[model samples]
Target: MAIIKLSVTERRRLSAFFTCLVLAFAAWIITVLSNPKPYVVKEVLEFRNTPQKRAFRPLQSDTVNVTINGTGWDMLFSKMNSAYKAITIDLHTLESKSYVVLSSQKDQINSKRESDQQIIAFNPDTLYFDFSNRKEKRVPVHLISAVRYQRQFFQSGPVTLNPAYVIINGPASVIDKITSWNTDTLKLDSIDESVVTRINMQPVKEGNLSLYPKNIQASIPVDEFTEKVLEIPVRVLNGRNIGEVKIFPQKVKVTFTTSLSRYAEVDEDFFEATADLDLWKKNGYKTLPVVFSKIPDYCHIIKIEPRNIDFIVKE
Candidate 1:
């Protein structure tokens, strides 16, 4: 409940004291961080100069704990840099040796990094790999896409990929299970026209597997759609007595939507409607349901008039 106010001179002295204390703290930090120190950071491992005669699969994880000797500034910035995430290891020695000593290649690895930072050591000081029979094969390329079309717009035809197949080289056991290689997802919104672009293929997850031509060209056909109506004759399927089975409405109207470019090319011949007579013989159904046995590609059926037809089976 007591108010004590200091004199202006006393307040100035207090402010100066605090300011000096802050400067001393900053000076200590600068002195300590300026000196070189060893710090540990985990980095991904990538292999280069892979042996051609043999296929390899690492027995351990693809990451290593690397001890880097550098100033505090270098260590701080290296962690923040995305490029520092992975360190490439030379596999040239694998051609003759089964393992690689990380320390022996420290100089080679440090050459690619900043001059201020040096790789001193790494955990799992030695890397071991398992060898397998090398094999090469050609597999089809599968495109992955997520596209949304505008109103009355659709894909008119199948998407075409340049170099429809890619060559893969890897361990025999791994390549045998892979039938196709998939491209990275091609995402688009409100697609109204054909798409022609180059997309990169998905990176091989296994370190040993390799793909030629990391990217490919893709072409997609898109067109506006319009409604078309056709009178399709219904054929009786699985009829024990074909001539004896009589169905009302032999022909039904088929309404469907097709691309504008192919509107005139489509007709009743492109569609096959059928009424199964087995419903009355086996299931004792009163009416037969009209089913479409075939339809043109990319054609979407909207409605079929008289879905179920009245039938009379003569004994």
Candidate 2:
């Protein structure tokens, strides 16, 4: 093997040549990207000025390939970014015709976009729609939620919505299948106090369906809960003809959880416990099981002192 070493001046010249070569390559790239050209990108379709008197369902997909005439930089950026703004299409012409030609509205669509980047054309140049009878109805709004409460804290009452129902207008076939609309999921953790906020409804997936008041006001009542005990007398049931009925335990202690606001108001009157005599006569059971006929709303029962009672009937 032979070792050859170059002079310092020769190495310096080599470095300068390579540096110029790299700079020239970069300059070429910049110039190419700065030049204007036509590029194709996919855009979602947004329909506006919908005919109020008719309902329509698009026969094709809601996406279209749009040819945009702009600089090379614009093309590169549009390809890099996945969230392109949707193209708005006017549907006022639909009142007379069932189809729309995109070329006819090129000027109008271009007006809403950046002046430098113009929409040259779009694939699926023609959009066809299926028409049906329009129907409007009011449907209840259902709340979707996943909440965790702090210890001894919980929802005190039913959640209330400012506008309990929303108006939905769409094709009769689609409207008939929809009974209610749902709000986006309300997620909360370690909640201790009441909540009041505005939440958006789940967006309509079908292009033909429309919802008014896309968002609603939600009021959630929350409170701290405590244990409440009450001694309720057990009443005899289905023992009409079996005149006198004596139970070993006449009353039972009921323990339950109730909100602080309602703790004092809740008492024996709020609950009803009864022992059915039919279990002893027909079922041939020796003891009668105590059952609750009524209980206050939102009150959770913990335990009953005497679940089964020994009763004797004197005929």
Candidate 3:
């Protein structure tokens, strides 16, 4: 069959319809681009400074999961960004019955120029906090853990610590968690009788925790306790001609104290005493000064301690 040609009026009507459709499409595109729909982004948010008691250990983690809203495209492109750092969370603001709701800030938004308040939604409006109030107590800091000792020494016994107890104040919820205080090892070894010394105290791991005194005091006992009287003989070193020399009452006295076990080890044989004889040779003097030779390490001069003695040399 032969096709029938369209009338001018019919053609005009079809053209008008096509033009209207194009215009509507263009308007729709502009509107969609100008006013984009919002998007939601999930991020880990942090809250800090939740009031911990001074005697309590500071909690290491304070982060919560949260969803943020922003530009649809921005959220689609990058939903998760940097790990959220905690904005300060004041624990003091919270009461036993309720929690404080922090208002979202402008900078809290996940996307640029988008308000976090507008796009963010929290699963729970406020996090529930549980606390048990505790009465104040003075608990002693015990050095229960044995510290590592230095090589060549053994700890004689349990070390005595000064001001062992600490006054702690916290809520009943937290005070129950505490146990006792500990310390680093005190080294005792190869120690002589004079080995009386103290060690420093160890620091607690928790920052919020408090002790009576910031420092720990410790004392280590040594095993050096013996007493002995040693008879020491004195001699003159490097002497020459002697016309005439005489020492009145010669020998000096010395004493030492150590443990009974090691008493035999302490004796006059441990030290040397001597006097200079060069003056006799140089002066060719008939009379010279008497001098003592060596002194023992394990002993000290007693009542008859002589600093100077007379000596005679043959000329």
Backbone clashes counted, model 1: 0
Task: Evaluate all candidate structures by whole-model CA lDDT and list the values in order.
Answer: 0.90, 0.92, 0.50
**Top of the candidates by lDDT:** 2
Q: Which stretches in model 2 have alpha-carbon errors above 4 Å?
A: 1-4, 147-151, 187-196, 233-250, 273-293, 306-315
Off by over 4 Å in 3: 1-62, 66-87, 95-97, 104-125, 144-146, 173-215, 219-315
Best-matching candidate per TM-score: 1
Q: Please give the TM-score that candidate 3 achieves against the real structure.
A: 0.34
Q: Is candidate 1 or candidate 2 better by lDDT?
A: 2
TM-score of 2: 0.84
* Higher-ranked by TM-score: 1 or 3: 1
Residue lDDT tens for model 3, 106-198: 234433434532535544445555444434667766654344434323344445677777665566555566666555555543453323344
* Model 2 poorest ten-residue lDDT run: 236-245
lDDT of 2 by residue, 1-315 (tens): 998888999999999999999999999999999998899999999998898998999999999999988988999898899996798999999999999999999999999889767999989899999999999999999999999999999898999997999999999999999999999999989999999999999998877789988999999999999999999999988888877889989999999999999888998989999998888888898998889999876688999988988988788
RMSD of each: 2.2, 3.3, 21.8
Q: What is the lDDT of residue 114 in candidate 1?
A: 79
